[model samples]
Target: MDDNDEDNERFVRLLRQVFRFLHLVLHVLAGVFLTAILVGLQRRATDPSYRSLKRWWLHRVVKIIGGQVSVYGEPAPVGSLLASNHVSWLDIPLLGGQTELTFLSKSEVKDWPVLGWLAAKSGTLFIERGKRDGAKGASECIAKRLEQQERVLMFPEGTTSDNKNTLPFHARLFAAAVTAQAPIQPVAIHYLNMQGQTHPLVPYLTPQTLMQNLWAILAEPKILIEVHFLASIDSQSVPRKALATYTEQQIRLALRLNSA
Candidate 1:
């Protein structure tokens, strides 16, 4: 590319980022009004009166972030355990917005600037990432939610991966479904660009600051995330280990991502 071309691209990205950033700030400010206050950090996430507020609030956040969610296949019935492949931090809001279900999140997310406050206000269950020691406690918490007839989604991969890879599923999480006897709904999430290929800018990877990835998403003019809900599995019948493997295969197949 010529020097002028590179300069123009930079200018465009800067302009886009500024415009979107202003909109985001205004949206956050809007949270003060009563209607918006319903989505406040103090609101009860599981309150029946505001059941859809969390989902609606999430949809707006994803929209502002330039993510357009497209769903394929039906989401499993309410109270089913939704299992999906992890991709980006955006996955939380993107997936949660479309499905009226609570999901597990990184414990640290509650401390993120604005998004942290938002996630904490939603029906989110927090877990410390990569601590096997906490797995049992996390699973037990998830089981309790499931037993309460709440739809709880979890990323069995336990961590995010680049679009080219699908990490092996951690069987420990599937135990939640077994304990609760809830059905497992396998979900596949894909971030596709305008060309329908995996979006290079959206994946969350090490060494890349979250601010950098967030800027890239905001600067882009278009975004598409496909959420495919696969067939439901009977957690009651299969052992958690088998349940984890099968659910992972379903998500990998739906995303059409080759194993690394």
Candidate 2:
């Protein structure tokens, strides 16, 4: 590109940021107000009722950010285990909106100020990776959730990475799927702009500067995230480790994402 192109890009980014900033404020206010109502409603909500409200809230937030989410293939069974590549925190809203699934996240997320509180309120499962017993407990909790016919999203890769690279998946979490005899639906999430450009805005958020993080999201031009739900694999088909590798490859192929 030329200087004019650079300038145009900068202008577009700036416009997006301003809009995002306004949207962010609206979302915060909406979250606070809606959360209070949800808390009250949860008291009288059946399991299915709670999932419906959660899905609606997630969809509204993703829309506010000007992100479009698309999913392929049929939704796996209600309680099927979903294993997907971790790209960014946005995965929360993207995945949350598309499916009525609970997530298994690291223990630290439980301590985050607002985000953490929201995850817990929304039925996220926090796992202590450092303790072996904790993992077992998490697996048990996941199984129970499946028994309730609620899907559970697990990022066996353990952490998020740049949009271009997917990390190796750790198979230990697969134990839960095996125990529950749940079909594992491997999913790939891709972020691209209208021109098929991979914008860093998709996976730029980190733990630092919560304000800046929110700003980065609000400042981006419209983002498009594609979620491909691949074929479901039976956990009992092979060893858990082998299943992990196969699932990883299938998702990478489905999204055309390269791995580090």
**Best by the lDDT measure:** 1
The positional error of residue 246 in candidate 2, measured at the CA in angstroms, is 1.1
Per-residue lDDT tens digits for candidate 1, residues 1-260, read 99999999999989989988888778766643433567544557788655676677667878997877789999888778999888888887787688788879779888987667666666678897768768888899999998888889898887788976689998988898998899999989889899998998888888888888888889988898898988999998688899988888888888876654
Question: Which ranges of candidate 2 are over 4 A from the true structure?
Answer: 1-12, 41-46, 205-211, 257-260
Clash numbers, per candidate: 0, 2
| Cα lDDT tens digits for candidate 2, 168-208 | 99888788888888889999888888787766766743564
Query: How many times do residue backbones clash in model 1?
Result: 0
Q: How big is the positional error of residue 242 in model 1, measured in Å on the Cα after superposition?
A: 0.7
- Clash pairs of candidate 1? none
Give me the displacement of residue 65 in model 2, in angstroms: 1.8
User: Against the unseen true structure, what C-alpha lDDT does each candidate score?
Assistant: 0.82, 0.80
Per-model TM values vs. the true structure: 0.90, 0.87
